[model samples]
Target: MKLLSVNLGTARPVPFTDHPDGVTGIDKRPADGPVRVAAPGPKGTGGSGLAGDTVCDLRHHGGADQAVYAFAREDLDAWERELGRPLANGCFGENLTTDGLDVSGALIGERWRVGSEVVLEVTSGRIPCRTFQGHLGEPGWVKRFTRKGVTGAYLRVIAPGAVQAGDPIEIVHRPGHGVTAATQFRAVTTERELLPGLLAAGDALHPEALAAARKHVARYGG
Candidate 1:
């Protein structure tokens, strides 16, 4: 697989966002040169891992587990066919637009070596929220997206380094688990019964997701 483009965004007022500030960093555009990728901190404290990218809502966005968001070009094309509109590389607010990658099918904890140095692990799937629905301005978008169940993967930076457009993505590691990003998305969203099963992913599960799964197991005896 290859990185089609490295995108970054700046904070700006979004007309329909859920944030009190009415601001969002969803307007990502491809950037030139190698961008530094590192853990920004925790979920509520850090923003995007890409140095110049902005994360507007600290309470709901950004953190070590969600340092980078990636989406496949093929998925975007699918959306475009359904929406009857063209979607650009970074249009979905993803930091990395990848080509020839089955991002949603990737197993949790799978590690990708980007360029020559940066390594990132699959953590979870991007959950559709009010901000995302509002950004799209499509009626029933959240429900539509949820039903599609092809949510892109959120990545945690493992080895900080520089990443650029056209970088090759090598799968250097894959956890011995069947819990894929799509599975995690369903578990947390529509398929509550599947939550406990995500524990099989172990530490590869995002902290918030792990907590949710544990809570489900405690309540439902999974």
Candidate 2:
């Protein structure tokens, strides 16, 4: 129901892997803290900008597109145990780490205005890819995710501004259909064949996503 923390990342390769760069979160940062949210150098797409698009990996991998993974604030503890390291401010490999919000259940078309600066539109759910498996170092990670059904969402920047950790994330709006991020994630990843039902339930999807959903529906909806 509220913004816990806004996160961004530098595209650093895993210390010992051939995989691509990843993003993470910083915890316990104050609302007024200077949270970095975008790339400060040339983007992987050969451009330079301060937009989230500049730092996000969705543009490069075409997998977890536009999604800033939101985990339960408590998951940080679990991850610390799994990874054998202490979770730190800006260290969870997510763009945003939040509390008091069930991100897995956030509906499409939901929007949040952060501290009068950034506006986020929930577009779709985060679909796990091999990169995630690599990050977790678990071979069946993606399958476990599919079965667990706790995936988060992809959000677009409607209004860009400075954000920091511990900022109170407030919901601007919630759609009526109740097609939450978890349902959308499953529909897109597990039942990718049933995309129109999902898209139809979304209230404010971006043009590209809308078009893709329409095309998929046309192709699979028979």
Candidate 3:
């Protein structure tokens, strides 16, 4: 797999965003040169791992578990066909726009070495939210996206370094568990019965998702 483009965004006003200041960083553009990738902080306090990227919402977005969002160009193409419109790289607010990568099919604990230094772990699937639905201005987008279950993936920075466009992506680790990004999305969103199965992924899961899965097991005995 390859990193098609490295994208970054700044804070600006977005008309349909829920944030008082408006949603900005969602509109990422491709950038040249090496971009530093590091853990911002804790789950709720951190922004993008990429140095120049901004995370507008702390409570709902950004953190170690979601330091970087990745979406495949192939997935965007699929969405384009349904929406009948062009979707640009970084348009989904992802830091890395990847090519030849089955992001949704990635195992929850999978690790990727980007370029030569940066290592990122797959944590969870991106959850559709109001901000995302609003940004696209597509009616019933939340329901549509949820039904499609191709929510891309959230990643935690395991090794900090520089990443740039056209960098090669190397799979460093793959968990034996069968919990893929799409599987996790289904477990959390529609198939609550599958939550307990996610435990097989162990520490590879995002902390919050791990907690939620445990809670589901406790409450529902899944």
Candidate 4:
């Protein structure tokens, strides 16, 4: 697999976002060349792992566990066909637009060696938010997206390096757990019954999600 584009976003005013500032960086555009990738500190303090891109609302977005987001161009195309509109790379505000990867199907804790040096581990699936629905101008978009179960992928930086369009991606590792990004999304979203299984991903799971899973098991009994 390979990256179709590397996208960056600039903060801009939007009436649709729930952010206190009423601004968002969801309208990302493809970058011209290599963009540096690194862990962007902690959950609330860190922003985008990309140098130029910034995450406006840290309460719901941005963190080491979600330092970078990737979406499959194939999935975008599918959405384009369904929506009867043109969907460009980075339209989903993903940092990396991958051409051939099944991002949602990737197992949590799966490690990918991007380009040559950058390594990213899959941590979770992105949840559709009001900002995303408003940006897309799609009513009931959140439910539709959740129903589709193709919520892209959030990754944690494992090895810092630079990435750009056309860079090759290598699947360097896959944990023993079969819990996929989609499964994790479903567990926390529509299907609470699946929450107990997410423990198989162990520490590799996103901290927030891991905590939720533990809470679910404790309350409901695995």
Candidate 5:
């Protein structure tokens, strides 16, 4: 699909902010069409255009779980409206922002290619936490996310490579299992009964989540 924004944190290790604390590069502008390259910005440390891994923390501070937020192409507008500003200077807090891809509905275990370098596998849904509330300055941000089921997806790197903002995204696989991001979120938060169905999803199941699902299935036996 189309590339929206490419974000990276700087290595300064300053206190976290509404934007990425250590933004090294940005790609919110597209060239030669809708596709844009999110290469290293002039402010970057090495100018290599590659953000070192681990800058993106999924489960650690962002939420209750390990991974948080795989953004979709459409949500960009909504986020802008909510934030009351344009997304630049690492404000969205997402490593890669894409357009024309329905990441909200992406199935767990699906893999997407970023250019020729990196692979992003859908692992889980972002469960809103207090941090999100603080960022949005809304008391009900988490509740809103739960009710809307618009929580972004969580992706793990299958491969690492340099990525820029305008890079085209290609879908490498459409998971055989039918489990979607909404289903996985329900399993984690509300419908404990759906846990078994998620495990039976087989290879389409994320490995990190598989262990818990199997353990639950052993007890639930649906």
Candidate 6:
């Protein structure tokens, strides 16, 4: 697989966000040059991992575990066909738009070496929120997206470096667990019974999902 485009966003005013600043970085565009990739510290404090990209709602985004977000270009094409509109490379607020990658189905904790430098690990799936729903302006978008369960993968930068469009992606590691970004999304959002099974992924799973699974097993007996 290869990187179709490396996208970055600038903070802009939005009417739908709960942030005190009322700004968001949901509108991303393909960058013209190579972008620096690094861990952005932790959640609620750090911002986007890609240099020059904005992450307005730090409380909910931009952290070491969620350093980068990736979505498949094919998925965007599918959405374009379904929505009957042109969706650009970074329309979904993703940093890396990939070609020929099964982003949604990628196993949790899978590691990908991008451009022979940066290494990123699959952490979790993007959970649709009010900001996303408002950004799209589609009625019942959150519910629709959850039901569709094609939520893209959030990545944690393992080895920082420069990444650009046309960079080749190599799958370097797979945890061999059956839990994928799509499967985790479904377990957390729709089917609670599957939460306990997500433990198979162990710490490679997102902290929030890991906690949910533990709670499910503790409360319901897995």
| Top candidate when judged by lDDT against the true structure | 4
Give the least accurate 10-residue stretch of model 6, judged by summed lDDT: 58-67
What are the lDDT figures for the candidates, one per model? 0.94, 0.57, 0.90, 0.95, 0.58, 0.93
Q: Tens digit of lDDT per residue, candidate 5, span 1-222?
A: 955655544333333233455321222222222222223222223132233423323223222122223577567678678757664523444555678888878888787888777676776776675555555465686787687777667665566565666777898988777788778878877777888888755755555456767888788686
lDDT (10s digit) by residue, model 2, range 1-222:
445665544454554333344442212122345543332322234321223422434343322235344565665566577657676533434566677777778878887765567677776766666656665666787787687777666666666676666567888888887677777766666776656767766447634556767888777672
Each candidate's clash count: 2, 8, 0, 0, 15, 0
Summarize candidate 1's per-residue lDDT along 77-188 as a digit string, tens digits. Answer: 9999999999998988999999999999999999999999999999999998877888778898899999999999999999999999999999999888899999999999
- How does each model score on TM-score? 0.98, 0.70, 0.96, 0.99, 0.70, 0.98
Number of clashes found in candidate 4? 0
Worst 10 residues of 5 by lDDT: 24-33
User: Residue by residue across 1-222, what tens digits does model 4's lDDT show?
Assistant: 999999999999999999999999999999998999999999999999998997999998998999999999999999999999999899899999997799999999999999999999999999999999999999999999999999899999999999999999999999988999999999999998999999999999999889999999999899
Q: For model 3, give the RMSD to the true fold.
A: 1.1
The weakest ten consecutive residues by lDDT in model 4 span 91-100
Candidate 2 displacement at residue 196 in angstroms: 2.8
Residue runs of model 1 more than 4 Å from their true location after superposition: none
Model 2 C-alpha lDDT versus the unseen true structure: 0.57
Query: What C-alpha root-mean-square deviation, in Å, does candidate 5 show against the real structure?
Result: 7.0
Give the Å shift of residue 110 in candidate 1. 0.4
Q: How far is 119's C-alpha from truth in model 5 (Å)?
A: 2.1
* Positional deviation of residue 47's Cα in model 2 after best superposition, in angstroms: 8.6
| lDDT value, candidate 1, whole model | 0.94
Q: How does candidate 4 fare on TM-score?
A: 0.99
As a TM-score, model 6 comes out at: 0.98
lDDT of model 1 at position 93: 90
